[model samples]
Target: MSEVYAARRTRLREYCNAGGSAAALVSRPANVRYLAGAAPHGAVLLLGKTEDILVCGPSADRPSQERPDEALRVQTLPGAAGGDPAVAAADLAQGQGADSLAVEEHHLTVARHRALGSVAPRLRLAGLGGAVEQLRVVKDEEEISCMRIGAEIADQALGELLESILVGRTERHLALELERRLVDHGADGPAFPTSVATGPNAGRPGHRPTDRRVEEGDFLSVCLGATYRGYRCEIGRTFVIGTAPADWQIELYDLVFAAQRAGRESLVPGAACRDVDRAARQVLDSAGYTEGLTALTGHGVGLEIDEDPQLSPAAMGKLDACVPVTVEPGVHLPGRGGVRIDDTLVVRPEADGGPELLTITTKELLAL
Candidate 1:
């Protein structure tokens, strides 16, 4: 594991050199983990000219976890336990003859940046932008494996919910039960908020669970995922409450299912993010049901629930092979419930079975 982390750091170091910065300070927790393999509290990875180092506060337990020790030297702050570790790192880089250092401006606060400038007046500060995030867009086999396991855990939890009695149960209770099942089956935690919406609330993305009781004929839409080793995956399904479904319910479900499939099938390497969203959006739009659609059809998922490579109308950028992303498209009518089907998939070259699907649950609309 440490070796893999070391290799990732080497790649990041190359990126730093290409940006004309002799050193870089990574502070974002996930970016720190990507480079150091473990991100202790108040820890920062500094890529120096002569030697790279992971600088942490005095409280940081050195090499206590899977953090890489072979690729970079570890340094601890002096005099205090919780001082800004970035300032200390920048001071050390200045002493080591570093002329310029790159920092993650998007993650770092304005005050922290000013503190670094005060400590190392000679060192030129550069914005690292999303270089680390750009490198993380492509998933290694290990990262993909974590997401696959998370998806499986989520699927198992959802499967158990189907076997039991759902009628008369409140949406909030069922959502909580599914979350407990996820942890019981082995998950780091919930990837995002567990959404269980019933009736008119169904198909709404990011819907908070409510006390709405399950009725005889209602559309119950659930969206949930699990996090395993910092990687996250999402799964969503829409089900009918009663033993039978209404014509409108079946039609809406089929339409959403088809749109979801189109979005999933569009997860090829080099496909534009907007193109994928358009593929799914067109289906619902043609049916005159495009009034209240979510902005994004899908988004990249890995260390974070929502990352780069957003799949939306105004989004730009071509997908690359090995990028793990989600494909979710739905509609929420004002007074009527809707349908949503979501899955996690990896963009892959056509030769290697383009777009590896991580979530393997069936897409067929089920009636309970």
Candidate 2:
């Protein structure tokens, strides 16, 4: 709704004003979508003192809103691949009497920043920093609902995969099929590239699918997520390829599962993010298998698959209610393969049933 966008922009405007800027140029697609409902390619949002405008290049696709938000005004630059939207936005800001404009330094490239300066020599540009990212960490009910549906779709796709035969299929085929299934189940697309690691690749975080064929007694790990209306959720599971798992496989699976459970249980309002990471890290550390652990047990998932509130040793933040994060504790042995378990959950107060588990698929070490 226009009112929703207007309220968000108002908050941003106040933030910019407090930072000594009368306008902010949002060049990051996610930030623009968060404030302007949609971000066509090469589009940027200019949060001015009086009006908000969405600036885009000539070749940019039009936003699909039949009736655009009244609070958002759209402006397209002339010529194909004409000019940078951020530069155009800066020019517009100067015309609108914006004395100082804040831009997302992390999102805007040095070249674009220079171009912006060149176009509006009098406009003072400041860094917006991570303001938009910070605002997105805490999820509203509507955003959470979209993520919930995405989690459900991912669960269904994984569940269907488990029921099918998997003796000699290549990793790429499985990954592609799972992606197709996600689309079939009402997903805009896969949140991120689907990962299907087998044998020595099992438990490898972000392992790209290869041509390796699934073997009879190998560890199979699959990590995938669905994007529903721009919200994303992730789910990962490791399974044994044969009728029964080896002794080493069972041991590693149990350890990772226990560690993952610890991480999940530590998610609560006011809990330090690093403390949550430690709870899971300690499990593998005590077992003398800490060398190959992922830097972070898990991370925040939202509009982008990996956003903020990182659950890592060096992280510095406290868990807040309504924040959704993934608790994925894993161990990857060099040539022997390993196990990883991941789940998406929302942090809530203990009285309200603690953290809500969005990925409901069984985490048991299943023998396929």
| Cα lDDT computed for each candidate against the true fold | 0.88, 0.91
Where does model 2 exceed 4 Å of error?
62-68
Query: Worst lDDT window (10 residues) for model 2?
Result: 62-71
**Model 2 steric clash pairs:** none
* Estimated TM-score for each candidate: 0.94, 0.98
Residue 221 shift from truth in candidate 2, angstroms? 0.3
Please give the range of 10 consecutive residues that has the lowest summed lDDT in model 1: 61-70
Candidate 2: lDDT of 341?
A: 94
**Residue 98's C-alpha lDDT in candidate 2?**
88
lDDT of 2 by residue, 52-139 (tens): 8888788877434323356678988887557788888899899999889999999888988999999999999999999989988999
| 32 Cα displacement, candidate 2 (Å) | 0.6
> Which candidate should be chosen as best, given TM-score against the real structure?
2
